[model samples]
Target chain A: MKTYLPPKSTLIVWQIRVTVLLALLVAVLYWFIADYFLVLFCVSLVLAVVFNLIYFPAFLRCYSISVNQNAIIIKSGVFIKHERILPFPRMIYAEKQQTLVAKAFSVSALVLRVARAATLTVELKDNDIAEIMKAVAKWQ
Target chain B: MAVKLKITAHPIMIFYYLKPFWFVLIIPLIKAIVSAVIKAEVNNVLLNELFISVVLITYSVIKWKKLKINISSDFIEIYLGVVRRRYANIPINKISTIETTKSPLDYIFGTQKVKINTEAGKQGSADFWFKLNVGDVKKVTELYPEKVTPKTIKFSAVRVAVMAATSSSAFTGIVLVVPIINQAVRLLGTAVTDLLLDRINKIGQLFSKFMPPVVNTVTVVFLISYFIAFLISFFKSVNFKVVFAGKKTGVFSGLLVLRKVLFNTKSVNSVCIEQTPLMRFFARYLLRVGIGGYGNRKGDRAVVVPSAKRDEVHELFSVLFPKFEPADNKIKPHKNTRWRFYYLPTLFLAVSVILYLVLSYSFPVFKGLISFGFIVTACVLAYYYSLAEYNTKHSCISVAPVIYANYTRWSATREMFCEHNRIGIIHITRWPVDKRKNTCNVRLTVRSEAAESITVKHISYNELTDEIKSLYQI
Candidate 1:
């Protein structure tokens, strides 16, 4: 059995993206709302950014993929720990998609899909994806 | 023998090609005609509409001319698009369902609109849709050599009507009319809408004068919507018939616009027997099958029996899907966890009490009505919870080496029977509280039009593991 975790570089890319989005939202809200409540809004924005930064690392720590000879088990979810078992024989398709930020960090989202609409999507580095794909091909 | 034929759809395809722009075409034409009759002259808007209409018609003609189907021995190729040409080649054996239907125009012209579907295509839509002449439809059917005379089952008009009424909801009916109502309001202006509102208010006044004050305009509107939904469903389900031919099954339905769908029985994933709250009152169940390329969307279920008794459903199951017949062995939930059923209703009651107190404090004007509504809702939910608990006690999961069957009753009772191959993924969820109890929730998903899941809650951890291991041999 092999366990794979997402690389640390993805976290930096995610934080940067979230920060930029938050900055844009703050700018928009600033123009519309009253000046009296600006201080409160700024404080709330700071807290939101702080919370987001902390959440990514905790989430990355919790998420993991374990591949065995016959099946792959994925552990995810932030508050309620979710474990999904995907057997190689039942899997029909595997798709790899990369967002702009993920591409820059050499990370991609791998979607392991069974029949119909049941799919498990996870982010992993290119090397990890190749290894998982190889295991999937060997088993299936 | 090798077969090769090149053909085009019926010329009536042009009507469907222009269906998307119906409002654009009709609105301008009506305006022009009315203006000409009233003012004795056509304006710039009429000329602009004429130009646009000509361009749209020309485009449709070119598209119809370009669309061609090439049928070979092994595959069917479709050449599509006028501006940028592209063709799709589908192997004959890979096709799952060949659905034939007729719109009003197609019926008039003796043409059938055919949809070729495959399991591998996108969900909720057919892979290919085109029109074919009656003779061409017969020719297409000839591509499959195997033939057998099928046994037919027909539904009675009364049963169909009852089933339609039970299955229909006010939301669906409102969805159908909301867009048309919006269009009417936009075109007719505010004076017409105000007059309509006045008439509705007058009706509401009469209702308040005679019946209870609760039966207001809103309730009347809801009842009207529900009736419309029932009518739509009734029309769609009229003349519903099911045919079983060895390894194939065919469904024929629709009143004005006739439809015929043929699919292989081997491809069927799950056979579901369901009863909504309303159906429960009549002691009836709606039996449907889940196939790869059919019933992917809401209201499109491949119904085997619309409204039938328990024995009738079981009898039909033996003939229609003998492989997925209900099993006898049952696995009940852990008895200690039965209290979980009352958890939801308790929560609702608690929320209702909190809301009543808060509203009474904030809004003294509407206190009496708010309290009455909340109490009624909470009571109904509690009663429903009791019913669900009783039903769940009777429900159980039946599993053999190669087949899995689940029976569950909540707001609706759903029983699903399927073979092992249809099972896609199994998820075992265990929380902190569940771990303490040494039990877990096992959710089993099946391969169908949509990923339908059957969840067995509060089952012993070791028992579930053993059952899964024996079933899947993992």
Candidate 2:
């Protein structure tokens, strides 16, 4: 985990901020048109609770992982739980990413795929992803 | 003998072509309603509809004129479209199947429309084309003027009788009246209930009160309604006339548009027949042939020879391929690769049944039917498939550039014979469970598609690798 720990990128923080902003925008829309503030208040509480439930433990379990071979196992979800075991063998492509919040946290993720590599956004230190990409592309 | 065909739109038939105009008129009515509701000026909206209708009518007329189609001893040629000026010439011998339809336009006007599908080349695409009346349809047939066709033999009388009975005048009229029949049934039910039981709002109330009895009655009515549609489909599918002459093979059939399609034999890509569960139950089935033509749309390209009794598929097959006949008796599992394809589907069913039972509380009725059918059919099919696979050891499959399978009711099973030489990319898939099992799900790519398509399923990895090595690879 220490050897592979990511140098958090500016992009990760940007993305997190963008997502949060979009969520708050939706929250604010409800605040204006809603006949009752009670429903809005209730919805916001539920959102915060759900978000915390999804991210806190999941981020902890996943953010500390490194693998020499095989796949990264991301454990997530509260009620409808899932484990995404992504194999390096299926890695057709890869990229490095960063965000401000992730930089603050000193963490990142990596996305890898065989077909649609664009969809597998692996958030990690730019150097780690560069090393991973060089190794994976050798198969092709 | 084929008589030459020169098709020209009858001046009177132009009125029949105006069906699209109905839509053209609808634009204005909608515009007027919107304009009135919003209190906007109506003139611009009215002018737009007028301008649009003129453009549509002009385009239709141009399409009618440029569509130069002719069937001769040599070939069938169709020149189509206004700006593109695309022309397709399919030699008579390349014809796989020809289908003609009679839209309500032709039905009312006593005219018929033709959609001819030939095999191999892209040229055999059917256009919403030039009109032919009943006599004109027959005249179009005469255009294929050639003499002493490939050995005239009287087609079986039983076949003729079946065709005639299916498409007899009364049968056709009733078949043609299906939508009306449905309307009539609804009307009759309302009329009878109104006169006998209900003086006021009563049908729904009665049904809600006498729930089971009402449910049974409605079920019976719906079943009959479905049967009526089936009967109509059967009738419409009959009365086919297949002609094999010098270079041309043509089919003259259809209730509405008596059609003739001619193409060469070499162009035929593939042919298959399917039996629905209902068809299997009643021993009556529909025969669909996919030819190499623009039959890309839903029903236009496939010829539906409906209501053939079981194994009576042999009757139509004679017209289609006439060369190969599968032995009548049940095949030994070892004889073909069909058995190898059965296991994955069976396992899939078992897994799905388990999933549904787990989820059934959300939808009890859906869950019941799913688990019921899955548990029952999956067990039986799995057993048969096991026997078939065990009995028939690794058998080589024929390669087609394109392959098709007979449609079955209980499951989705397609057979393909894609030419290994032409396949651009290949995928060998195995799920987590399948990896231990050592079975490969083979998928092959086509040029036009974005990704590879599943060509076949459930062959042992060893057998699959060997087959790919020996046949597909050098």
Candidate 3:
């Protein structure tokens, strides 16, 4: 089995956009409070570099996700690598969360709660959730 | 638990009598007498004494009017207060513990206080200390047993009897001796007063007139306090009794005004045998029960055990809770964090003391020495406690999906039971040093009695990983 992008990419994007907006607003507020807040422009650049350090590779790995017949495994965590496996039969519920920005971006969530209560979530197009949910149900 | 088995918790009748009644009244009266003597006024002495007596008598009468208690097989009910009568009726099933307390004071007066607590709700018990008129506690404990007390309970009755007699002697002697100590202290005060006669006379004059013989004021307020304390003590001692009355499966026990309480051996989560440093030196121990709920979680003062001798432990426990074994071997926890040398509790104290001495002008030498001594003592004590904890901890799986972690730290062992299903999430944090050592720490999130998630620490990195996978069956 191959795990696709999460069915809630649009929702995740909306959340990220909102977060970014909040950060920008805070930066503006800091600028109003202290003139030296402009130095944080450099800090944000450094932060963006740090984010991409993990996120870029993780995104690539996520696209290439594959697993055995029983489970779809996602390998992550740099120092303590975790191989999270979601067994199809143990999948109890699945959902997609979408925010306005994510809807505009056409991204949604493919969220699944396994019998063990471990949450397996992947960001993807909203269309992927129903298909994935149906396929997992049929497989189970 | 037979249908015919009737039980009762005797009413605490002593609340009607003045508590340390005379001890409370006498101090102000004495101060007034002393003032009157110094001033050479016989009328003032007589007036103060009469005023103190009136207050004591009025209090005793009010209490006598307020207290009423009764019990049947199903319930133990109490109606208290002459003014705003407060009523409480506890069903027999709600009773969680029946404790009989005897102080040195209780033994001297030939009385014991019976405290009965029930598990009606999560916060389901109150201690009602009553001087038992008769001494059969077995009759009281039989009312509520997790099961009936089994007759097979091992008893060191000989040892228990000896200890009980010895303990009982000291309390009475102490009460009787209190007068001697009071007089001696008073004599010392008198000598000091004479030496500082001119100054003390002026001070006494200012204090004497202000001491209106009201029930709650005056520097001699402490006098009435002790009088009340003495009365409580005498009442607790008079009919002091605790019996190791063994029933079919549990032990039934209480002092004079009988109370039958039942505790299930299996139901108890942990038992804490404790003492302050002072009590530890005296070899005195207090046993406390810690169950799974939050209601009984935090308390330092517990019901006084009839005796502290180790030999009588079994007999007492048998009557209280038989399923619980004093030497339970099933669950013991391993010491993962034992490097006290790495922990800077002692160093911090020493450094702070040194800093205070160097920077502060007030009694610097005394503070330094005291702080240094305390730090050294605490370091040594903690090292020992950590070692003991290591030896006594072990974990076992008795109930499915529920693991019990038994820990003995600070001479008090507590067992924590956590269900695998109850774990919300696991967080593994690695400090810079830990990362170098490849030993990460695990935090398990559990919903405690308050229903909010509580994160518990100190599980090994490898063990946490193993537990995670084990919880999920393929």
Candidate 4:
């Protein structure tokens, strides 16, 4: 059995994505209500800093993917912990998906398509994505 | 025997073909009527509607004529489109489910609706849907391979009637009645509907001395609706039968409009035995199986048995899938966490009592009625909560190559049997409260075209991890 932890670059990418989303939200609010633009901007900045510096790292630490000959087990969630297991025989196919932002960070998302319209997705480094795909293909 | 390779859909296809464009087609007719009413152009309006009707009919006829299907040894080819002329060739072995249903409209037209589902397309909608003549439908079904056997089972009318009564609920009855009542009001016009409402009001007023008129009227309507729903269920379950051929299972039933569905037994993902609180009391069960490419909506999964006694259900299940059986060993919830089951209901009872005290004082005239109603509601809720607790205590799970779970969902209890290979995901969740209690919830989802899940609640956290570790060595 091999356990893979997401690279720190993936975490950085996610933090950047969140910061962009917060900036967009504040811009939208400023367009609608100019009176409170400064306050909204300050709140958004604090939220982004707190979330990226504290919450995201804790979340990344908790999330992991373990692959064995039998199944792929995912352990995730911060406060309300969740452990999900997907057996290999139930897997239909696997594919790699990379967005422009993730590509810039050398990170990509691996999607495992299983039966019954269920999908499991996780972000990993390019080498890790290749290794996982090879392992899944061998099982198939 | 020589088989026909090329086939055309029945005339009933016109209805399906026009369904999507009905709104667009009606707008012109409505415009014509409005113009005629305002401008007194009756002659022109008649001519316009006639022309529009002729064009629509001609379009549907031409489209129907152009649409054709060719069934080859290894593939099915469908020729579609009026001007573009597109074709799709689906491999025969890739077909997942073959469903044939006859709605009331199809019955009137002497046709059957066929939906061919494959895993390639959208989740809820079928890949290929067309209406065919009864003879053509038989020919189509023949093209699919099947190994016929002698095993068969039939559901009797008496069992179906009992099942209908036990499974029927007021909510379903109300949903089925609302449309019919709306249509009736439209047909009867304002004056007749007003008279009916006035009579109902008077009846309610006549009972005002005893209780609130609204309550009286609602109770009567609810009872009537429930009875109507029960009758509908009975009719739907009439003449239910199942035939188990070697690799294929065929189900045939329906009252006014006969329905037929054929499934590849190997493609079946899971078997579910469902029982409502009432059915539990009567020791009855409804058996259903989840098959690939089958819709997930209510009444979509193939019903192996509509309703049956406990022993009969077991017998049928053993015959259908001899290798798999319901789990016997039970894992009751820990004694420490058992009180969580009654927490919500006890809170509700307390609130109801407080409300009674406050409302009785404010409304002196209706005090007796309020007290009686609240007390009855409290008693029923208490009874329901006790039953739920009993069910929770009995919930069991087995983690093996094939998982078996019997768990309570809301007020209904469902027993799920599924193979490990067919399981999509096993999720063990620990909420904030559950973390404090040292318990967790386990959810198992079966793999099919649609998602079907079974959840077990309030189990010891250590026990769950141990079970998962034993099964998958996680």
Candidate 5:
């Protein structure tokens, strides 16, 4: 079975943007309630950085999706792994969505909708969308 | 063949609008009563109420005349709405279910309100009523002549009452009332609260003096609430029956308002058999089916049997899914997850002990009593947790042409059976601790628009994954 992963640069950029946003929010709070919030915010920021550093590698390694004859297999985890096997026949629809950041990075997200279940989303290069769509079309 | 059936100038439609007319006249009726009581002048007030009633009647009559219904070979078209002129064209094949409701007025007038539900239609479902002699229902069914000969199962009034008494609806009522009671207590001043508590304690003491051991106000309240819950449940599920026809399953239930629901068996995503703690003692189970568009306001599932014995459930399942035998395959969760069951209760017990010791210093008089109560509560909690653990250990999933899963949620045990291909998605979740323990939770969702899902917790992760892969041929 072949494996697919999201672009590493996109993940890193998204994480940095999120971290910067949180830091800005914390800095604004420090200006108002600076007594213990400063220490709390600093600790939280350090923990977030450490967490991302540890999690990103595991996420890249564990997060893999593949489509076979019968089903679509998605494996993802940081500390705990989850492997979902969604049958193609049961899928209601497949949607391709691209966020502004993802569009800039030339990566798109593919979501497969199944009834009454959590949709499976795979972030990959825009080129892969056609292949995935073809695969889903064949099954349907 | 095209068949045109227009619903217009029907007296039944007048009865349908009667409630709204009555609702509109409530203020006028109250005014008339007040005038009679105050000034002994009822003529003017009565005239005003009569005028309002006449206007409402005229409006209903106008609305009734504007409605048009056409039943064709391929589609059922409904044209109504005076100004906007709303038109709904529902295909015959897409019609999921047809629900009929009959009130006392319907019985008197020999009419029934029919709601035609289609698969996720834009208008939800088309609702209209016509003359009973019209045979509109037969005309609709004739479009799809391919029928399955259904086996009918009717429950006795006694059985229905018992089922109702043990239903979760009663528990829901009790749950609803608790918040209201708490709010009332809060709104009432401390003086009233103290007085009420004292009176309750006195009553408890009186009962205790006659009976052995000490009884408290809490115990009395609990007993009273339980009785109230039983009464509520009994009333909710008074008359219930299941009719299994070829291709369609009809559930006829309700006490004050008779509801008859006919749903296509092909649309049913899954069948669920639930047994609460009280139900276990009675050996009765509640059966419900998950369909895409047919559901109550509270839940997206329809009850086939509100309560039934083991044999009855087996009989029903035999007809519903002939290829799958529920008793043939039973797969249990791993035994290693027993520790997970006892963990929360043990933690709660420890916390209670610490709190009791700390609080004892403030209210020293009831120290011994509080400690005794805490110990008793802990023991009960431990016992219930053990039962829950046992139920979890017995949870299993069987896969064939159909998938049957037996799992426990809180104190209730549920057994669900569905077509393997109908399953929307399969999810396996594991926390960091669960990963280390090699145990995870598996959730199988049915392909329905409704929020119908089943989860089996603390099962061996690898074993379940391998089983699913092999069974589904993934």
Candidate 6:
């Protein structure tokens, strides 16, 4: 089974963005309360950084998507792992979508519309997206 | 056949436009007459009513004139709208269902409303009319002769009545009547309201004279609403039957307004056999089918069997889904995982206990009653959790070309069967605790915008994955 991982830099950028957002939230709370929330904010900031440092690497490592002749397997999550197998026949459509951040990072997301109600999104390099689409076409 | 055969709908459809505004017209007309009699100034009120009536009539006339239904060999095109000139071209093959409804007014006018429901979701059915004198329902049925012919199964009047009486639809009817009841109370005045309440209190006194006023009032309201609900349900499903012809299922029902509905069986997303608490005691089940395009956006699904015995349900299932089996090989969650079901309820009880302790300090008089209520709630929660655990244990998934899932919702258990090919997505979620326990929640979603999903919690993750891979050859 072949495996593909998202760009490592993209994960780092995402984590940095999340950390910044949390810092802004904490700053807003500090502005409002001006109490022992300063201590709580510091603790939260450290915990968030530590948790992200530990989880993001594991997530990057574990987050592998593989497309076979019949099914697309999405293996994700760090502590609690998820291995979703979406069969080709069951997939309604597959499209490559790029957000502003993803476009800046030169990465794209392959969104698979599965069965009636479920969708699976896997991040891939811009170049790899075309390859995945070709693979999907071949399977079809 | 001509290239394009254009025809105007029966003139009765003009009334369809006016039907919605009838109340608007009637309310003001009544007010105008009352004001005229009370205040001797009739000209302004009468003029206002006449002006509104004229505008409504003109609008309906314009709408009626513009509405044109063109029947081609391949498609049915509807052209209407005065300002926008809207055009709708529905392919004949894509037409999933055709329903005809006949109100008392329609019967008197020798006409009926024909609603053409295409495989379009949410947009709603396209309604026209059939002039009983000009064209019979046979003309529409003749267009799809092969699909329309089916073996009909008519429910007995007694059976229909029983089914309706036991249905939860009565509860919804009771909810609808609440506003009407309120309006009536307001219109009739407090004297009538007090009399009714007194009568209800007297009836409640018969049950338990020592009961609190609040409890007595609640009991009386419940009894009255339940009776009204029974009447509504009985009337709604008075004449119910299902006609199975090839791949199409025709449902004919209604009492005052007759409804003849037809839909393709292939479009059925899932079959749900639901039984309310009352029906559970009688061993009766209501079988409803969710259609794909329509989704489960309320009343979209057709009730093939409104109410039936266990054996009758089995027969209905066999007839509807001949290729699929309704029975399942049961799967049980690990005993250790039963904590998952009990965790939330136990936490709730703990929170309630803390609240009781805190609040009892302020209100000492109600402390004993509150404690008793809390204990009763805790006991009920414990019993409910036990039932939920049992439901999880019995819930099973089977694959035989089609997937059949047997699970419980609240106290009522249901068996849902859907084609494997129709399954859109299968989601398996595991929490950190579940990771350690090796148990996960599995959800099978069918293609419906309404998100019709079947979730089976606390199942062995490895077992389910292995089973799916082997069974589906994925």
TM-score-wise, the better of 3 and 5 is: 5
Find the candidate with the highest lDDT and give its number: 4
Candidate 6: which stretches are off by over 4 Å? A1-140, B1-7, B19-55, B72-74, B123-136, B147-149, B169-219, B294-299, B326-364, B367-386, B467-474
Give one digit per residue, the lDDT tens place, for model 6 in B1-474: 243556677777677788888787956777787888898776976988878888888988898887777676766666666643444444554555677777777778777777765433342333333433235455656655664456888888887776776666565334434434443333333333344456787654443433344444554585687777787667767788888888878888889988887787766777888776557657788888876544223545778888889889988888777866643544457777866766776788788788878866775645555555566567657766755665646666765457777776666677788877767799989999889999888888876544467777787878888878876798
Candidate numbers, best TM-score first, in rank order: 1, 4, 6, 5, 2, 3
Q: Please give each candidate's TM-score.
A: 0.66, 0.47, 0.39, 0.65, 0.61, 0.62
Cα lDDT listed for each candidate: 0.72, 0.49, 0.45, 0.73, 0.67, 0.68
lDDT of 4 by residue, B1-474 (tens): 122488998877776777775676666677777878898767865686668777877888888987788887766767655633334555455566788888888867778888876554457777678888878887777776566654788988987776676666743445434444443333333333344456787754444433344444655676686777777777877888988888778888889777778777777788888887677667889888887776635523778888887788878888888756645544556788877778778888888888989987886655545655686677678776966576566777877676888887777788788887777788889989999988987888876666778887788888777867877877
The docking category that best describes candidate 2 is incorrect
Off by over 4 Å in 1: A1-140, B25-56, B72-74, B142-146, B170-215, B326-329, B350-368, B399-403, B407-410
Error of 5 at B217 (Å): 13
User: What does DockQ come to for candidate 6?
Assistant: 0.03
The window of 10 residues in a row where model 5 chain A has the poorest summed lDDT is A113-122
Query: In model 4 chain B, where is the ten-residue run with the lowest total lDDT?
Result: B184-193
What would the per-residue lDDT of candidate 5 be over residues A1-140, giving only the tens digit for each residue? Answer: 55567777557645765677778878888888889796868787786776567766567767777878888898888778898998976654455555555666676667665543445454577677657755765564
Question: How much of the real interface does each model capture, measured as fnat?
Answer: 0.04, 0.00, 0.00, 0.04, 0.04, 0.04
For model 1, residues B40-148, the per-residue Cα lDDT tens digits are: 9877778788788889889999989988888877667676666544444555555667789976877679899898776655687876789889889888777655677
Worst 10 residues of 1 chain B by lDDT: B184-193
Off by over 4 Å in 2: A1-140, B1-7, B23-98, B102-111, B116-128, B133-221, B255-263, B279-288, B294-427, B432-438, B443-456, B469-474
On TM-score, the stronger of 2 and 4 is 4
The Cα error of candidate 3 at residue B346, in Å, is 11
Task: Report the lDDT tens digits of candidate 2 across residue range B1-474.
Answer: 253776666544445455766755855567676877698565776777767777767777776776566666755655555643443444444344455566666667776656554322234244235566678777766655668555332334344444443433333333333434444445444444444454555765564446545445665666566566545554444455556576545554545434445554433333445433223334454444433443543422334354466466657566555543432221121223345456566677667667766766665534434445455556656654643353244222333323322222233222222233335567778877557666655655532112224344555667656645755554
For model 3, residues B172-253, the per-residue Cα lDDT tens digits are 3333334444444444444344445556787655444333332123324445555565444343333323333333122333
Write down the lDDT that model 5 would get: 0.67
User: Each candidate's iRMS in angstroms?
Assistant: 8.6, 20.8, 21.6, 10.4, 11.6, 11.7
Which prediction has the highest TM-score against the true structure?
A: 1
lDDT of 4 by residue, A19-130 (tens): 9999999988999999998899899999998899998999989989899999988899989999889887766445566666787887777766564344545578888877
